[model samples]
Target: MNDRVNEWTPRTRAVAAGRPSGPGEPLNVPIVPASTFVAGGDFAYAREEGTRTWVALEEAIGALEGGSAITFASGMGAVAAVLDLLPAGAGVAVPTFSYSGTRGLLDHAAKQGRLKVRRIDPSDREGWAAAAGELDLLWLESPTNPTLELIDIASLTGGKARVVVDNTFATPLGQQPLALGADIVVHSATKLIGGHSDLLLGLAVATDETLVAGLRAARTRLGATPGALEAWLALRGLRTLPVRLAEQSRTAALLADRLAGHPAVRRVSYPGQGTMIAFELADADTAEGFCASLSLVVHATSLGGVESLVERRARWAGDAHVPPGLIRFSVGLEDPEDLWRDLNQALG
Candidate 1:
């Protein structure tokens, strides 16, 4: 690792942070597929110690997030690792509406009496502040999934409990949660960090040495290590994250403005940043129709790819609280005018 990397801009750090530092080394870190390395050195088994590929990915992400990072097999794996940091029967506060996967995990834990769960609206600063002292963890999502709601992260930190922010939607380029007073930041690198939707990976970053060690131990004990190829692919995608996010955010803003003025769209939830937007129609049927009617944009479930995707969020039973007419739209690299034209025709 180069000490000079700390001084560069985020964009430059994204591109330059994880490359081989020695003279005449490869420009990109090659995929090291070894499961075990001969005695000594930093690694023995892949699961317990990790490979150079994973190290490269961690270095890049840690540089961008300003913390030590641990990679996982999937986004939920990262989430679970963070949750594992809490003691047994701990009290945790989460967003009332968030990624269904996370909600499902919390529900399962609550059902098993592993933890006490409290659902709080992301915008309720007072509720979060009040609950901060009693809770063991504050799990938050900014520009939340599907709903695209923003939370005041700084306002809720500095309590007795540890604070973890899901930086998946906002991405490191969009915001630095640690700098905003969060103890940890997590990302589903499977989404925007992978850019092309070709890989699945997750990361948890923390400035605290104890928390970082705990997350690494969790990954080892849970066998949640990411594949060598996936880590390499994520690293490649990260190199372009800054540019990709910039273009997508610009187009999202344009579409959001247009959607807000359209009669067919009753409401538009866009935090005025990031590439995600949630727009409401009259009913579930209308929302489904809007998704089905698109030509260029894809009608699908996951988000954050180079191609646009739209889906009726309420279709999932776990997301029943979401508006039946809400469609979560993920803007991509498509020309803004072409995307708007397709959306316009679809709404008709």
Candidate 2:
């Protein structure tokens, strides 16, 4: 359907919202992998062109977000599109512990003098409010990457600046930032939205049509667009997101609770919510050794998949601001007992 959608429960929306009319359709959105397309239809060209797979996923996600949604080549591409809206001198306040690509983009903006970017601990509501003047936007990454920090979004935003939550971790299934009073919601569809790490994609949703138009304009011009095949994969992922997330969340919490009291670990940070969790070792040497000891869980950086994964956040300078011994864990759909057994021995 070409018309926009409003909320139904997210679980309901994930399956129905984006499907297009077809000649005795196959029931699932078709993954069109074309860089070129014929004019005279809604999608003229693949560049300015649109894809059914992308639209289906966008509509489903947008419906849950209660806004217009757009696709990007990757999560950062989605970030770049929204950040592109800031004109010269417009300020952006982001948490210090954020995804590296986001920090890098803000740095580029600062260097170009196109935007003003500042970092604050997300829980500092008073600090964020005080810093809001002339700040065109605020970025929220709750239960932030690797650190498991929380940002009460409703508390951080002021009318003076727009708030955009990076809902990659919580996903729409776990939290609805817009419903919590955010102006915009962003996701690296590459992560939780896709559920499996098979494809790269990004999504942005905003209640404001004008803002969405501007984001689309940026995406269209920069050619940072998602492919139909990838969009379809994301849609396939969405169909099972609720079930996957619930299992992952349960396993993650089980592991987090177990790790916290273990003698080898010094600290744990789970945000006491959905799947992602972090813990700090006594030192980077211990942290690296623990990762090396793992047998079942892959020692890797990315999160949100069917298999458990672990990464040392401090390996990247962007997360350099975090504790040097911190380990970020992305819970998978494995049997909780298997993950618990593997992780406990790994930590030892």
What lDDT does each candidate get? Answer: 0.93, 0.83
lDDT of 1 by residue, 98-180 (tens): 99998899989999999999999988888899878889898999988889888888888899778999999889988999999
Off by over 4 Å in 2: 2-7, 21-23
Backbone atom clashes (below 3 Å) for every candidate: 0, 1
Give per-residue lDDT, candidate 1, residue 45.
92
- Encode model 2's per-residue lDDT on 1-348: one tens digit a residue: 535345356777776778776689867878788776676778767767477777788888887777788888899888998888877799899888888889889998899998888888866778788766657898889977767788878775657888889999998888888888888788988887788889999998988788888988999987899877888898888888888888888878888888888998888998766878899888888889989999888998888888888888888877777788889988888888888788888777
| Full-model lDDT, candidate 2 | 0.83
**Alpha-carbon RMSD to native, per candidate:** 0.8, 1.9
Error of 2 at 72 (Å): 0.5
TM-score, cand. 1: 0.99
| Candidate that would win on TM-score | 1
Model 1 CA deviation exceeding 4 Å by range: none
